[model samples]
Target: MFLNHGSFGACPAPVFEAYQRFQRELERQPVEFLALERRLPELLDAARERLAAYVGASPANLAFTTNASSALNAVARSLDLGPGDEVLLGDAEYGGMQILWAYVAERTGATLVHRPFAELAPGPRTRVVFCSHVEWTSGRVNDVAALCRLAREAGALSIVDGAHAPGQIDLDLEALGADVYTGNCHKWLCNLRPSAFLYARPEVQDMIEPLVISWDFHAPSFPERHRWQGTINPCAYLTTPAAIDFQAKHDWPTVRRRCHDLLAAAELGLEPLTDDYVQMRGFRLEHPDPPELKRRLYEEHRIEVPVFESAQGWVLRVSVQGYNDEADLEALRVALAAEL
Candidate 1:
């Protein structure tokens, strides 16, 4: 039962069924799917409309990507950074993004500044402040409004990595107002794997080139340059609207509240990292348990969860998505009782 949600994320029966239907249709008419470009504009337009509605952006202002990492890499590499240029970021960001920025900085001579967690203040010479809305290890949601305001005051461009915040909480893109914001539908929205999005305010959109250069090289149009970057599986990208609809159909806000309550009860002895961020709860184990704790959960307990080492401590992270119930959390609680 602990495997019912989170981890790879539990797809609702309807969305999974819809995805299978799309796959069958593609297999049945490969030629037609390939030839969809003449009408691609319309299909993508529909996707944009649904995406914009879900995230509160103008339909014309978003682009699709396989995942959040790809989007972050594109933005990081495209920025015109050189010697003395500094990209400020919180130490708590996802590891993959840190590597991407380091690679870009190596060639361009820009330094990647790891800002102290307490120095959330904005300052001059900070070219880009890349941040995660919620820390992956600790589940501590940042004060984005405060950070963005500081970025604005100091002339730094804000790039938010929102991989865990979107479906876990309500998002108003304009209200967040970062120069670049990227997130994953696959993580919490229950879309198929490799579905994510990048949103840039219209003025800064030109600075982020597509990760793969393709047919839209000469076209000045937004969708032209972004929507059809390459030839690959677009099933996941196209089905995000279905995932969004599935969440609404199930009344997910109520589900999230119930999950939060269950987690609050379970965190009594576990020492949660965040007293405030309640969606993805992280706890410090009381003993130096072997890696077997993670393996045994899957091998014997039929549970799939994540436990990783961080700078502050070892963390057992659990994401409570809509499909999860109190029983799943209870199972983990019982397992901890036995193991630790």
Candidate 2:
């Protein structure tokens, strides 16, 4: 049984097929499909429009990127950080994103502050605040909208890393009001890998530059410049609509509710870290050796779940998707009991 949906999501068969169809079409007519700039732009625009509506943003402000990391990188590099500038970050932020900001601080001589939550008071030198909508380690959901409001009031920009929020929860970018919001379509959205988006408010769009300098370098608009980063396999990006359609056709809200219930039940006895998680939950484990226990669960029981060390001791995260059931959770419970 697969229980690690939070790590890398499993795409449904229909969406996978649609992704393959796009790939085949691209391979059949590489020049005709990808080189015809006018037609390609229209198709991309249509896809972005659908995605923007789904995420509660205007298509003009959204740009597709390989993943949330790439989108965050664009924002991180573009920010005018310098000596004496400070960027506030939540202590529970994802490790990869933390590394990116750390690199920015190292190169630009800016200070990066890590606080336990987003309720910190910004100092005079604080230029921006970085936080996650849904924390990866604890599966905790942060009040990003409030954080953004706090940042704006303090004369700081807000960048929300929403890598786990797309299809897991209903998102309204306008309601969130963050300066820059980046999220993954591949996780809860059940899209193929290398598919995600970045939404920048129109006024703040100019602050971001494309990670790759390409033919669209001189493009008049922000989306135009960043959306067409040097030609690569755009099949995953093109198939995002199909993924969204699949979820809609299957009544995904109901499925998500069922998954959330399963996750809640599975978290019994283990300390609940978050009250806002949907399909995934994180629990504090008493096991001294979580890594060995995780390995043994997979090897001896043919179960797949994630257990890792965290600030709050060992953590065992469970992801319940449409494919999961009570039996899967029971298997995990049995395995954990035996292994631990």
Model 1 TM-score on a 0 to 1 scale: 0.93
User: Would you list the C-alpha lDDT of every candidate in the order shown?
Assistant: 0.77, 0.87
In model 2, what is the error at residue 171, expressed in angstroms? 1.1
Instruction: Assess every candidate by TM-score.
Output: 0.93, 0.96
lDDT of 1 by residue, 54-75 (tens): 9887766788888898889878
Segments in model 2 whose C-alpha atoms lie over 4 Å from true places: 36-38
Candidate 2's TM-score reads: 0.96
Which candidate should be chosen as best, given lDDT against the real structure?
A: 2
**For candidate 2, lDDT tens digit of each residue in 4-24?**
988897899998998898888
RMSD, candidate 2, Å: 1.4
